[model samples]
Target: MTTTLAAGPAPVVARPGPDIASRRRRARTRERTAQWLFLVPAIAYVLVFFGYPIVKNFVMGSQDYTVRTFVSGEAPWVGLDNYVEVVTSSIFRTSVVNTALFTVGSIVGQFVIGLLFALFFKRRFPLGNVLRSLLLLPWLLPMIAGTAVWKWILDQDGGVLNEALRAVGLVDAPVHWLTSPDVALVAVVIVNVWVGIPFNMTLLYSGLQNIPEELYEAGALDGATGVKAFWHITWPNLRPVVSVVLVLGVIYTLKVLDIILGLTGGGPAGATETLATDSYRRSFQEFSFGTGAAVSNILIVVSLLFAVVYLRANRRAVDE
Candidate 1:
């Protein structure tokens, strides 16, 4: 009864040696390398396509690059002379004014109309989806084709718009939509707004969709309904989305060339000329590549400033 089994020795767990630890470190390094390898294609694509063009533009902006430069194979370095000429030119003032008016008018029209449409479509109705899909036609159509059709519609004579106005007694004669310098800028802005409306509507609709229904219901219970509710509840929630839409609208409107070019060709005596068209004219039409590059570089700087502002605002929104 007093006999007991002898105690067995403690089993020693093997500690990782230097070799095993080194092998583990190597495996981790390999895993990280594999992860970064997946990004190579994207990085290379950006560097080749975006980086090269931007760098070339910057170089061209600093030199006297032109048609003759092509023949001579010598682009004499001019430093900021191109920029100075661009800024001091008489056309520069007109382009700046037109650009500002075009941008502001287009954004305001697009945002207002798009917001109205989005609010309208947000309500459940018969064939709402169909109508919403139809609204995207402007955005989906080819820019050149759309602007061409718009040109015909806005023509001074034998145009649908003039005919409609005359038929309705709104105008006694054809209004020179595209031919008059005074109205050409307005016409271009109208076309741009038409093309841009669907984009704003789509983005704003998505943002509206994300707002919680409970917040609205709660607001209603407190007697904040309709406009008041929208102001106090909906607007506060939608401000971040609004900021994004506005910034993007400004950026896109700033560089719009096709709409203006197709509709006005930067004329009726350069009435609708913007920075974009001016740059194109300087480089291709006039063959002053340096000046064109300089104008474009200025545009790039403006766009970058807006982009910076957008990033900061977005970060703030996220933090809140």
Candidate 2:
């Protein structure tokens, strides 16, 4: 009849074997793999440069590693003897105390001064960018060079700092900034603080810039301005960055060697001898590699403990 009796079931149309989602999934996987391939070189470089030394240090800490081990490659296992000796040594307590003081002092000075500088830079002014760039010179200079310059500035008799103090009538006699045990650590801390300030200021300023002007404007409408606005808006917004800066500063300051070594050489009756310098003395100077590794391992643990505390505090802050 008219329709050829039901048209024998409409002709079947061919459909794609895979769903759109499936095709997209395959494409995303390929893209991710390609992106990861680009990162392989960087990952490998880090493993070779950082990972190997960490592992080697751990192994050495557990063995009777020495200068001879480097030549003969025969390091006998000594278990925790190295650690025991390091912990019991007379210098251990002093080094620990010095390490704590150095890290705390440097971090406090750096963060406080850096925050002030960052706030100063936030204000609009002529040549502001140029001034900020110039501030980075101290940070850009090599650590040894900065330390050498600082040594001259803090020298006992002929240093500029002493001369300035003498001119200003701050003291009766030239101060022994590096030689006197009482003030050597202070001098080292001052130099470290100077070198670290630019880094902190740059990071903090970046954080401040990331904040939207709209937030400040809105807060201003709600009777929030100046110090009040900073407490309510700026501080809250800057907390995460501040946390990172503090934690990184602690880690870096804990391992500071160049400035201390160049300035005081951990001398004047070991006034400036922190764990880092002590570790260096043991390994390179005294050729007690195992003891040096042990001290370094302790430092690593301290750094890790601090990082853990910071993470917990950050989590609590986020939750609240």
Candidate 3:
């Protein structure tokens, strides 16, 4: 027992030395730095492109920014006066009404026609892909060019459309599509619908492709074929996609400017003056930067509302 001799002063526990610990700490710091480095470009891009403009727009909206401001280098603070004036103006009412009509008409026309096209193409056929690709030409063409062509086609005199109508005896005289205030908005809507259909068809077709064929086969066994199968199986499966398409269509249609501007230039009598065109008219045409920014801010707010709705619906779809 005495020969145990205090167990040789206890075994020495080998803890990390200062050099090793320091190396570990440095490695962790470097890892964190690398992660931040990877995020730097994205963060900077967002700040420069999105953040600054939003802030600048908000600030300009609060100030009396105009041509004078550019010359004097000072935008006087006018608080909500610009917004008040814009909202109280008579054209504001007209613009709002026209915007609603344009958006609704475009969305309805695009979705119904696009869905029909998608369903049709879902069936096997020769040159189906070729025809679908041809449909995309409208979507692919430059907006200005497309609208320019549309203008020629809709011209009151010497236009192909009126020529065809006359050939078929559909009407005795030209429709004055872009000239008459009553019909200008309708003509603009038709052009927009034509442009938007391909987009909707592509998205909806992708969604249709994702649906499992087994479900349809199983549905047929239960007497769910054709419209019955579509209504019971396809529609329920496609509801999420439909919601996304409708919301996106509404949002895009709300902000449409180029087509309307190129086709009607805010129309024969402001018949097609939407908030987008009105904002452009104010900022550049009238040199009322404050009012234009105000109108744009209103539009941004409306868009945000739809975006929020989209987010909620998407989340709901995911949960289901």
lDDT of each: 0.93, 0.94, 0.92
Candidates sorted by TM-score, best first: 1, 2, 3
Clashing pairs in 2: none
For 1-320, candidate 2 gives per-residue lDDT tens digits of 46555556778898766787799899999999999999999999999999999998998999999879889989999999999999999999988998899999999999999999999999999999999999999999998899889999998889999999999999989999999999999999999999999999999999999999999999999999999999999999999999899999999999999999999999889899999999999999999999999999999999999999998989798789
Q: In model 1, which residue pairs have backbone atoms overlapping below 3 Å?
A: none
lDDT of 2: 0.94
**Model 3 lDDT tens row, 1-320:** 35654555777899999999999999999999999999999999999999999889888888999989878999999999999999999899999999999998999999999999999999989999999999999999999999999999999999999999999999998899999999999999999999999999999999999999999989888999999988988888888888889888888998899998898899788989999999999999999998999999998899889879777977786687
Candidate 2 has a TM-score of 0.91
Cα miss at 159, model 3 (Å)? 1.4
All candidates in order of lDDT, best leading? 2, 1, 3
**Candidate 3 TM-score, C-alpha based:** 0.88
- Runs in model 2 lying further than 4 Å from the true structure: 1-15, 18-36
Per-prediction backbone clash count: 0, 0, 0
| Cα lDDT, model 2, residue 183 | 93
